[model samples]
Target: MTATAPLPDTAGLRSRFDAELANFLDRQDPDWPDGAPRGVFRTLHRFVLAGGKRLRPLFCYWGWRGAGGADGTPIVVAAAALELFHAFALIHDDIMDGSERRRGEPSVHQLFADLHARSAWRGDAGSYGRNTALLCGDLCAAWSDQMFHECGLSTDEVHQGYRIFSLMRTEVIAGQYLDLVSGVGDGSVASALTVIRMKAARYTVTRPLQIGAALAGAGADLMTALAAFGDPLGDAFQLRDDVLGVFGDPAVTGKSILDDLREGKRTVMMALARDSADRNQALRIKTLFGNPGLDADGAAELREIIVATGALDRIEQMIRVRTEAALAALEQAPVVPEAREVLAALAAEAVDRRL
Candidate 1:
């Protein structure tokens, strides 16, 4: 099987982690302070390449390929930049969410904090860890900017990519604010949908693909096709995330169970639960969500109630429907079949993963 193969299937793109990432890391260090180690680069590299879906890069590549771009080198490097950017976001996200793990491993900040605790850092160990990780996250973000600029794409394309990245940053930050507020009961489902579109769906899936298409010199028509397909597919992506946030395994997913509930996230599941439930059920939800003190049995009971109320089944159906809709959108798209393979596999497998 090639590197970009489908889940539980054979054959895929060349694994960009080793060769491509090594080259990317070379550009990161002009010089290292003796004995300090390239701690930042090493840690960021591990985090970025940590057994992941490589979804952003793959989305970017397939987007370019779908648009008939011959310049694979530029796109691959550009795609790598996307993954770097995602790592930057996730580092900060784990910090904000107080999430202990990522992709079934210690979150960068948590890892640093744990190390600091063991080694007797000067200040508070957790603070030391958080601050260090924050700096590293910024460094990684800067490296992404440098990578895209130096990826050998046209000047115009590079500038356009920067512009999109800027827009994405602004939009996702706003979306995150809305999401945070919504969890506290100050926002509505409409707002949650908006957040979903701006934050998770677009950056995680849609925009990366669009970036690839743009780099490929796709015309307005193809851009429209991509946008048309990106919106709903992105929604499905976030929806699955919501499901996983509630139901996924801690070990396999590398995130704590009921994380979204504990965080009081305004997911589609939460929204549906609120709308369909009785006042008692709603009170239970409100009381349980984001309660860090809630025990495992309490969480399990909540999950049971959610399932017994048919909410879990309802959410599953939504996933299935959204999955079909994404497939249909792809069918309607005017792209080469081979190019579609990676994306279709990603979309399907994102939801199909055991976690």
Candidate 2:
């Protein structure tokens, strides 16, 4: 067999992505028409650059390589565009969830709200903040599209990828809608899994991978193979995130451990816990799980209930199974050996993380 090439430098790629993102933002007209507020642009700059795992871009880059696309500026710029879209999703999601922090800093809406309060602005601070943040999210979405199209790739490659990009966007929005309804609807594991598949699974991993592969003119079979690998990995990824949301340290996660419980997110873990809870445990969960004013004691009780119900253990098992399935799929996928090795490592990192 021919010798496999060495693995690409992921840390260097991450730095390049960050630099490309910063440069793209810097090129935008932050100050326009003499009266437009620059704070929105400045905030977007900080929020995008502040912190992120950059999982989406890395997946995209690997997918490109797996499909025989060469390393170059075009792929890097295109992959980085995904980060802008992620910022849009996160900014909006935080507003919907009423989250106070992200990546160890004030969330976009909270920052704007605090600014309004501190400036003693004429409008309701909360409303002003939400509205401004909404605009900022919209701006990020627009920028993502612009950056992707202008990434210096051939028109055919960009066009192929845009189709997948559009579908990913639609699916995530639909999933978000389902998530809102699921909070009031039956909290079944099936429904929760549906949300994961659409909202996080496909959006997070599968679509990014497919978009990259498509850009490289990959055939349908390879695209399907990447999906097989990405879907399970993405499921495991979200499940781990759910665990961290409830159990992770704020200093480590840069998010409040209480926020998930407070929002009563209809996660698979919560659904499983509800399914297995005992009588008093069920009652306590009903009382405290979604309570906006849930305190430390209530959160502690909920954690105990989740553990006693065996929900935590079940979720962990699910994560392991899905992670294994993803790796198995990756092994069979018709990708370069170097890509396969790196992807297997990524799968482990995705499912086994404190953050």
Candidate 3:
């Protein structure tokens, strides 16, 4: 008799998680009338399967493993649900930011807009595109909940997962609102950091870990340790993302260099630059930072300003410090051996990645 090979830790889990999504999408109910908008499902399938780091799911899976949950399919299914929720977030985020591209292709709204234009359908192509994408996002959110509820955990386990799930969804939406509100008034470093904590820190790492830990029925001590590790790592991750948004190669990052500056994202990097700029440099920034017509020259000038003010160096140092703190917390936590190693590696990647 031949023996089956053991699954390779997280990589195997990711592949299986992706396969679950594909299988679910492929098996959708065809009994629905032909009048049903099947194209929306198709579009969502492509969007969810397309390029992403799958960071949230990875954190979730590791969190489950770290909490002494036995290797099985249930945890993986739960983790994949986070990806669906993330799809909802990204779809709406692109529309909100008016982003043209994501993962090196037209964003969901942009894709719909292009389709409308090419097909010569409807009254207003842009509005149609936006509305269609909004529906798609809402569908993803609904699907996330559906997937979570159907994962076949025990009733108590499901209830636990739901608590984390509900709280996470609420926090991210509230964080996004905070982000939008910050754009209108004062663009201080403190406000930007607050946005980072709510939007990126908790949603990206902390709550996902907590959700997985909840699935395993982890104790308060373990949850606290995970939060201590996740908070700093997530903060560094968002800070690195801000840096990449402005300074990274478009080919490498698959995002426009000018989008954040154009949208006036009010990021920590920008806040630090504003804090340190001289009078004329400050005026130049005030004039060009949020200008819709900010061209390459303007972007280059902004980049130079950020660099000259030492904000980039300061932020880099902050990333290093936060990464060290996360690693330290991970070292002290009583997590399983393999999970500890994987999470430690992920911490470094989260703070120091190029894309």
Highest TM-score among the candidates is held by which one? 2
TM-score (C-alpha) between model 3 and the true structure: 0.96
> Worst 10-residue stretch by lDDT in candidate 1?
1-10
Say which prediction, candidate 1 or candidate 2, comes out ahead on lDDT.
2
Better of 2 and 3 by lDDT: 2
Q: Which ten residues in a row have the lowest lDDT in candidate 3?
A: 1-10
Residue pairs in candidate 1 whose N, alpha carbon or C atoms collide under 3 angstroms: 4-12, 4-13, 5-11, 5-12, 104-254, 262-290
Write candidate 2's Cα lDDT for 1-355 as tens digits.
Answer: 1223444688888898999999999899643447887899889999999979999999998888888888888989999999999999999999999999999999999999999999997979999989999999999999999999999999999999999999999999999999999999999999999999999999889999999899988889999999999999999999999999999999999999999999999999999999998899899999999999999999999999999999999999999999999999999999877888888888888898999
Residues 71-152, model 1: lDDT tens digits: 3467678878877788888898787787878888888999999988898867797887788889888977887888888888
lDDT of 3 by residue, 114-186 (tens): 9999999968999988999999999889888878777767778878867988998998999999999999968
Q: Is candidate 1 or candidate 3 better by lDDT?
A: 3
Better of 1 and 2 by TM-score: 2
Instruction: Mark the 10 consecutive residues where model 2 has the least summed lDDT.
Output: 1-10
Report the number of backbone clashes for model 1. Answer: 6
Query: What TM-score does each of the candidates earn?
Result: 0.90, 0.97, 0.96
Model 1 earns a TM-score of 0.90
